[model samples]
Target: MNGANLTLEVLKRYGVDTVFGYPGGAIMPLYDALYDSEVKHYLCRHEQGAAFSALGYAKASGKVGVCFATSGPGVTNLITGLADATADSVPVVAITGQVASPLMGTDAFQEIDVVGLSLAVTKHSFQVTEIEELESTLHKAFEIATSGRPGAVIVDIPKDLQLAEASSKPVLVETQELPVAQTDSIEKANQLLRHASKPVLYVGGGVSLGNAVEELRFFVQSTGLPSVSTLKGLGALDPQDHGYLGMIGMHGTKASNLAVQECDLLIAVGARFDDRVTGKLDEFAPRAKVIHFDVDPAEVSKLRPADVTVLGDFKKSLPKLTTEVDFSVWRKKCIELSEETGFKYLANANNPTGNIDPTSMLNELSQLMEQTSVITTDVGQHQMWVAQHMKFAEPRNLLTSGALGTMGFGLPAAIGAQMSRPDDCVIAVSGDGSFMMNVQELGTIKRFNLPVKILLIDNTKLGMVRQWQRLFFDKRFSETDLSDNPDFLQLAQAFDIQAETISQPGEVTGALQRMVKSENAYLLHVRINEDQNVWPLVPPNTANQAMLEG
Candidate 1:
């Protein structure tokens, strides 16, 4: 057996059945091995697409996503996706083939110091120097990625190692110990819980990342804590729960923003105080005494200082910190606010040109889609609209570029997610500009014949940037226009995917039903007014309480 064979075996043992990647000259040996391996490999048009697909797979499935890339340009192309994973704390293992060992530092072709370029983007970067270290290194990469707060890890294997003789060696997997929460800290948190009349639970993506969604929901139900979510934290709490207000942040629901500002105590669970979540840091949840719970000690007080910090695994910590709370008046107030200011599909006014309101359309789509279906989005107005108006059954159901906000994310991610969860309906909701960013990924869908649904929300402009330009920069709308976009129906047909277009406001439900119920890969081209902007915007550096409404 050669090293390439050993790598596959190691991955299989780690429970990875599928991977996404692109092949290059330096990585040809591994690709050759993959031809007959039990592991399935999907070739993507760009290395960036491969990486993003891996991210989508990981985010959607709660498993460590794996992607392969070869050499300098391939590795560089992976940087953006890695940065996105790093920022979102997604667990992904990226393997890249480096130039052969003999050509080290001689300015060899495609040699750009893969480890050096990726240190900032990965939790750990490994370069296999010796043949014996390959298996162990692969094992370590998976452990590092999944331990504590999940993160992306890179393993740079030199080309020579792929051809080296391989051995089936046994490596002991070390169990990582979780941080123990201090007894006094738990007592203090309980005391805060008992005293806080208007306490709110600020849930974040960490709840899902830590696999503590069930625990979180139980605690929320038991305590009857009024709650708000960060973008990534959207589905952590039941959307229909009495005390649950929708997402909170720049484009969050008004009730969430108002409630956060008015709360007397904030129980932050597995959530960081992000700038997007806290519009104005100084005034964010100002009146609340915070009790922060997280697995990572570094993030506990990184932004807003926690009055009580519980550092430990959430699965263990949530149980000990559970307390009895009575906030009937506070819960009622939040529910009233949510009902008054929440997104209502038919309630929103249509654009003068009769274009569909993205908020209303997304809410309608949310109702149309299966309860188990997954939704992924590229960065822009549509992403904010999805976050504000759509509903997800779980955090994993909404795969998006939350932290990095990468534009060309939706398509490739949908590719990864569909490949992983073939039974579930996966949809990529994108704006015209963001959709064009990685349109070549259409080939990937064609090659696999994967039943991934695409909802191209075209506004003939970079809607988010245009909105900012209109609101902040004198409405110049420069360079954001894409009025000359290719006919999307033809594009999908060229890829052998079914396609349809919808312009009338009345066509939304029927179009959504057709796309969702399609047996093959489908693309739904939705054209709305170019001037439409995401609502409930909290202008930069302002308090969430002072959000600028549409």
Candidate 2:
């Protein structure tokens, strides 16, 4: 069998049903093999979108995502997505067709040093010179991506090697399984919790990867410590759960951000303290003693110093930590904070007038979907609104590019989520500007026959930036306005997908129900007033007290 066929076989063995990429000269052989393969290929408009789509697929499916590309520009185009996945620790396998091995360093046409360029952003990368090495290397890439601290892995295969002939070897399993006792970190982490009066459990994307939600829930329930999430960690605990504080960051709810600052002990699990999450690092958690637990040792103390760092998987760490102590005191404190934080039902407050507020729309959407639906959002004020207002009933319910803050993410991500869990409701909420970034994917959704309800919040502007411009830039609108938008209903009709436009608040629920009930892809373009903005924003470089109300 040829190496290209062998590549397809290995991917099938790994249960990879879909791949996202763009074809180029060096990758023609692989594409030739893919023609006969069952693995579906998504020819993205750009390789960067391909990689991001793969990440979205992985996040939605809880499996390693696969993406293919040709060398040089194709590989370079994947750099940002690789960095994004690395930062968020998403499991993805990027297979790039390289120039022939014989002409490797000759600067052959369209050749680039992909392995070197991607090394910093990937767990490990390979350049296959021999056809016999293909299966084993591909196996290793999947293993590295799914095991321990999940991340992007690059497999660079020389074009000639894919066309070379050899008997395909039996399926290869290359990456070693994670060790059993990553629990040492949990035990040490427990000690930090035991002594502290005000302990806060800071969760991250790693918790979702490890499927440690139950254990974290048990630990939080037992300890009664108020918990806050980085954007990536939004659904780590049930959003409506009593102990859960709202999301913490620049656009996060005021309570969670304040809790991070005031807590005496910070127990960070599976989450990196990115600058946005930490705000001004020097001022972040100045009074808090930090205990960090992560599968990747590098993440510990990467941004802020930790009094104790646990280098292990959160699944093992969380369970072990849960068993070690009495959390009665912790629970009381958390309850107190939850009460103090104004963590209440979404419908508790009412805004009866004006254009459809994104926050109100999101709150209503949460009620409509309840715990059964998974919601994804593109980057914008709408993204923040969903994070702030929507109730996440389960882990992984809220998906977004928190670390990368990439726009054009919601639609493809919703497709991926729909593909993964077809029976459940899936919603992709995007701002007008963000939706336009990758609206071409409407065809992708239609072709796949995925029933994803796309909620297009048409504010006719880059709402987040416009808000900042209004507050911080002395109302210099600059390039923030997106006054012109094509009719989304007509756009959906063009793709052969059903769509409806709703302008009034009263019609919001009916529109959602109609879209959600549809058997095929549906788009609901809710025309929000252009000036409506997401509120409770923390203005840049300002004290917490200086937070601007929207």
Candidate 3:
């Protein structure tokens, strides 16, 4: 078998049944092998879309996502997605085709130093020059990506290697073993939980990635502690659960921020103290003694110093720390704060003015959709609205660009989410600015006949940037206006997809219902007020408690 066939076999052995990518000259050999393989290859409009789609697949399915690209620009196009995945800790394996081995350092056409370029963004990378090492290299790449704080991994294979004959049989790769937290450390954490009068649980995306949702839920329930999640950590506990105080951070809920600030003991589970979460680090959780639990030892004490560090898998460690705490008074205070500061959508039901509020539309859509429906979003005010308003029943149901905050992530991510969960409804909530970034992917949706629903919140300006300017920059606005936007409904129709426009308050529910009920791809373009801004935002360099409310 040639190297290309062997590589495909190895991927199949690793249980990768689907991949997303665009074809290029250098990767043609692998494409030829893909033609007859059982693996399904999705042809994305751009390499960035392919990479983000793969990331969405992994985030939604809890499996390693795979993508392919050719040399140079093909590889370069994937950088943003790679960085986004790495920052968010999503497991993805990107395979890129390189020029022939003989062309090394000769500046061949379409040749670039992919290994070096991807070094900082990837968890690990390999450039395979020898045909014999192809299988093992691919195996290691998969293992590295899926294990130990999952992140993107890269394998760059030259064209000659793809064409070269290999005689070795594909071997099964063993999964890497992760370290467990020390027994004494677990005991210490338990002791801390047992003794604290005011304890809070801080959750992050690692809870879902570690498959520790049940463990975390049990920990919160047993302790009767108030819990708050990071943006990526939303849905780790049911949003409806009384224990959950919603997301905590710059745009976090008032209850969560207040709880974090007042707690005497903060149990951080699988969450890093990201700067956004710990605004003005010195003042964050000022009175709290932290018990930080994480799978990555490097993340411990990398930001805020922890009183006690539990270094191991959260799935294993969370179950072991089973001490209950009594914080009923504290919990009551948190619930009261939540009720006082929670987002309140305006009653647009019978408004005389024909303005459709984005928040109200999101709330109505969330109520209408099934509990298992997956929602993806592009980075903007709309993304925050969904995070705050939408109810997610499962951790995997909420997929968005969290760490990197990539704008063009919604539509492609919805494509991947729908592909991964064909029976469930998948919605991509995007802003006008973000939707246009990779709006070309509508073509991919049309070709695949994907039943992905797009909720385009058109405000005719960069909503988040405009809000920042309005609040902090004296409303200078700068280049944030997008008044000349194209007709999005017509754009979707041009891709052979059904489309609808809703500008009035009463039109939202029916339009969303029609879009959701459609058997094929559909787009619902919503015209919202351009001056709308995400509320309860904690301005830059401010304490989380000092949130700016409308």
Candidate 4:
């Protein structure tokens, strides 16, 4: 068999049944092989869309997602998505076609030093120089991407290699045994948990990335610790659990940030102290002794120093850290704080614009969406609103651009997620500005007849930047207005999608219900006031406790 066919065989062996990409000249050989191959490829309008779709598929399904691109611009276009994958630690393998082997350094047409460009964004990048190295390199790409902490990997193959004769069995790369936390460290953490009157469990995206959600839930249940999650860690703990205090960060809940500040013990599991979560580096969790748990040692004590660290797979370490504790008073305090400071959408406490409140609408959406459904969000006020108001059963059920905060992520991610789990409802909740970023992906949805629902929150402005300017920059709102946004309902209709618009407060439920119940692709265009801002925000350089709730 030739290299192109063998490449497909290797992917099939790795259980990669679907991929996303746009075809180009350098990649045409593989595309030709793909015509008759068992693997399925979903053509995206742009290479960036393909990359995000691959990431979304991997994130939503907990499997290695694959994407393909040609040399030069095709490979360059994928950089943002790859950077997002690296930042978020999602497992994805990207294959790019390169100029012929002989054209190296000669600057042939469509030639690019993609391997050099990818180094900053990917866990590893491999450029195949020989047909003999192709199969093993592909296997190694998958292995490195999925092994510790999960990350994106890239493989660049020259056009000549695709036509070169090849012979190699599909070989699997072996992973080193994951380290267990030292017994003394586990004992140290247990001791901290046992004697502390006030302890808070700090969770992060690493919990779900390590496939330790069940283990984390078990530990939380056994200890009954008051818990708070990072943005990416939202669904790792059961949202319905009384102990869970919702997301804790710049735009996190008041109860969560306040509890973390007041706690005596902060048990950080699978979490790095990101600046967004920590606010002011010196003032965060000032009263707490930290127990840090993570798969990567580099992240441990990288920001906030830990009193004790459990480094290894969370599946093993989380179970060992479970301890008996009595913090009934602290738990009651936290619950009271939640009741006092939790989202009061009914009161219209923050915005008085007399328009449909996105917070209330999303809260209702949380109730109406199925437990297994996936909700992807673009970055802005709506993203934070979804994070603040909605509930998720698993981290996979809520796919957001956490670390990278990339715009145009929602729609393509929704496409990938819906393709990955066709039986489950997938919704792309996008802002007017963000929706326009990858509006072309609507073609992919219409072409595939995908049943993905779109919730376009139109406020006629770049909401988040406008909010920051309004509060921090003396209301000098320059270039944030998007009043020129095209008619969304007509745009969806242009793509042959069913569409409707809703602006009144009473129209939210019916629109959501109809979108959820639709068997075909549907768009729910929602209009809201332009001045609304996400509440409970920790202003720049301030402590998490110094939140502005207006």
- In candidate 2 the C-alpha lDDT for residue 496 amounts to 90
What is the lDDT of every predicted structure here?
A: 0.90, 0.79, 0.89, 0.91
Number of backbone collisions per candidate: 0, 2, 0, 0
TM-score versus the correct structure, for each prediction: 0.98, 0.92, 0.98, 0.98
What does the lDDT come to for candidate 2? 0.79
lDDT of 2 by residue, 428-470 (tens): 9898998988887787776667788898888888888888788
At residue 360, what lDDT does model 2 achieve? 66
Q: List the residue pairs that clash in candidate 1.
A: none
Error of 3 at 284 (Å): 0.2
Per-residue lDDT over 4-28 for candidate 4, one digit per residue giving the tens place of the 0 to 100 score: 8989999998999999999898888
Return the lDDT, model 3, position 190. Answer: 85
Residue-level lDDT for 419 in candidate 4? 89
Off by over 4 Å in 4: 170-172, 347-353
Give the alpha carbon lDDT tens digit for every residue of 271-312 in model 3. 989988988788999999999999998989998899999998
Model 1 per-residue lDDT at 145 = 91
The alpha-carbon deviation from the true structure for residue 138 of candidate 2, after best TM-score superposition, in angstroms, is 1.2
TM-score of 4: 0.98
Query: Which residue window of length 10 is worst by lDDT in model 3?
Result: 344-353
